[model samples]
Target: MTNTHIKTLTAAILFVPLLAFAAAPGSTDSIETRHGRVDVIADADATHLLVAGKKIATLGVGSASLFRITSAAEREYIIVQGSRPGLHCHYSYRLLALSDSGPKVSKEFGECLDLGGAGMSGAEPVVHLNSRVDPEAGVETYQWQGDDVNLVFESPTLCGATGFVAQKNAAPVRAPLASRVKGSGRLQFLSAPDAGCAMPGVFVVPGDKVTATLASAAFVYASYTNPKSGRKVQGWVPRERLSDL
Candidate 1:
């Protein structure tokens, strides 16, 4: 063969093996866990969950995406997000725990766009998932408890702007006996503590006097007495909208 042809042939030989061993597009690498490596293998028909090369579970029939893998002292937790066939916007997640018997579903949360990101909060790792269609469904927060995942908190706001759970269990403190609405516009008084709930037509405008009794992370339970009707309306209002008088 000519030297030019020989060099091209040699290069082709070197490249063939690299192609054979190359990772396929859309294939995810194995993730290390406390037990072993975990993998999500997808095909045209189904998506499979594997541990140490052994098939553990079938995640779904369509698309499945790995959200997170968290390890604790006893076991490893895997969060997988998937959508139903033909419903791209409707998504859900499954929490799987790795055990000696195999990997098993710990918990399942449905009807979310995409579960919020996972991260560390102090010493504990936590995951937050937000609702896709229902704003009132709010956000669900989870944390690892040994091998199992626990839903520790649920926020009333879409962005999870509340720390109510942390303050929920704390010793009760004295709040201002009375306060006045301080915002420029009318503040919605929700029937429930959640801001996402439909307004019941109850509203408090600036300079309106209200009594603050109970308080949550982002809202406060207020009793407002209408001066004209002499009627008392009790509901939850945004905490920031009230000022101590």
Candidate 2:
């Protein structure tokens, strides 16, 4: 080969290896905490959870494309979601704890359902699991005490209704039936108390009487008896929408 041809061939041989390394699997990432940093690596076979360069766990991808990492308070967790063929799904979560000895895996929770969402809630940062139990979805709360995570509250998952378990309040006194203020226009009824939950629409007309069954900080649960059909309609209505009859 000529001198120029030999130089060109030599350059190609050196460049190919660098390209392969960039595309290689088993890449690693890190997230920093108050004390040190946590490490994660993804390989062809499974994703590895590491801390201080020591592998703590190997999480297979299973039916998911990747894993999701999230943090709450001072705690960190890894989440993986996957679906099966028969409308079944799984949500897996593993909590990571950092100590002086090393990084340790605290607890692993695997929930089987259609799979919805999980997050921290309430004043003490309890874990809340929101799943589609029936046609409706509600929250099941768990409190972490010491090394034990105990189920605390389970909300009813019924369409157009709300109930709670383990609530320590006296029976809710239904407010005397009240009429929609004459000039209040149309009251806005929601499927849930939160504004973005769902707006099913106002089920009652102006001046219709509605009894408040439950009251919260921002809204009231009201039930109305239709004058014509006698069917009962109940939903969340803004507390500002009704006046004493």
Candidate 3:
């Protein structure tokens, strides 16, 4: 998946075959979902999907292709996919929850070499995300439990071979909140938000106050004195992982 984001970017740059949708000339447009109305707004000349009037996600320029509404367990889901056509079509998907607050992104697959079979359902409703990389392929099935999403199942293996199923691993445990010496609780911690990015040599525990040294659209690079080892460490983590204190 190293070229995932690159492929998405390239698709955005390429000329897209326009779909059959009527446009109202304005800064924003609205579409109805099972949960609520989603408005696509223009911000700084870029297109963004707004839920509850809040910017939930940005739509790649010229990359908008299809919108699919999926129903499971009496709830609704909105799927927006961008694909680049060729011998090996490159594509990416964003899974959103249709909720009272609007739509919230649950999973983002930057760009897949080959993607298929996004539908899945059960008592709780699961969304299947699959990708194939040459001879190796994998599937990650996720379920939205309340407002949080959980990766309940995963299988990876050589193409056309039987794959072993495994439960998704839990997030790393953090130190107690009482030990926090610095940094606001709103600050997010991450494990690489994008492909090919380096993860921290060790995970940052909650109690450690880390200094953010760099910022990007998707991640922040932070440094902190490790409480366990007393050594200084730094790495890139996703901006979405941190919540308000």
Tens digit per residue, CA lDDT, model 3, 1-245? 32112211100011112122222224555556566666655444455666667777776532433344334445555555544445365666565667554556765554653433333232233434565564245555455667656766555521101011101111222431122323444333333333333332455544556654444444445566756778876554554443322
After superposition, candidate 3 runs with Cα above 4 Å error:
1-31, 39-45, 52-55, 59-62, 72-74, 82-90, 132-135, 156-245
Ranking by lDDT: 1, 2, 3
Q: Which scores better on lDDT, 2 or 3?
A: 2
Q: lDDT by residue for model 2 over 46-69, one digit each (tens)?
A: 666666676777764333322223
> Model 3: how far is 227 from its true place, Å?
62
Error of 1 at 125 (Å): 6.1
Candidate 1 collision pairs = none
Cα TM-score per model: 0.47, 0.46, 0.39
Q: Root-mean-square deviation of each candidate, in angstroms? A: 16.5, 16.8, 17.1
Error of 3 at 50 (Å): 3.1
Clashes of each: 0, 1, 1
Question: Could you tell me which residue pairs clash in candidate 2?
Answer: 26-42
Name the runs in model 2 displaced over 4 angstroms: 1-24, 30-38, 51-56, 60-115, 123-185, 196-202, 213-217, 227-230, 240-245
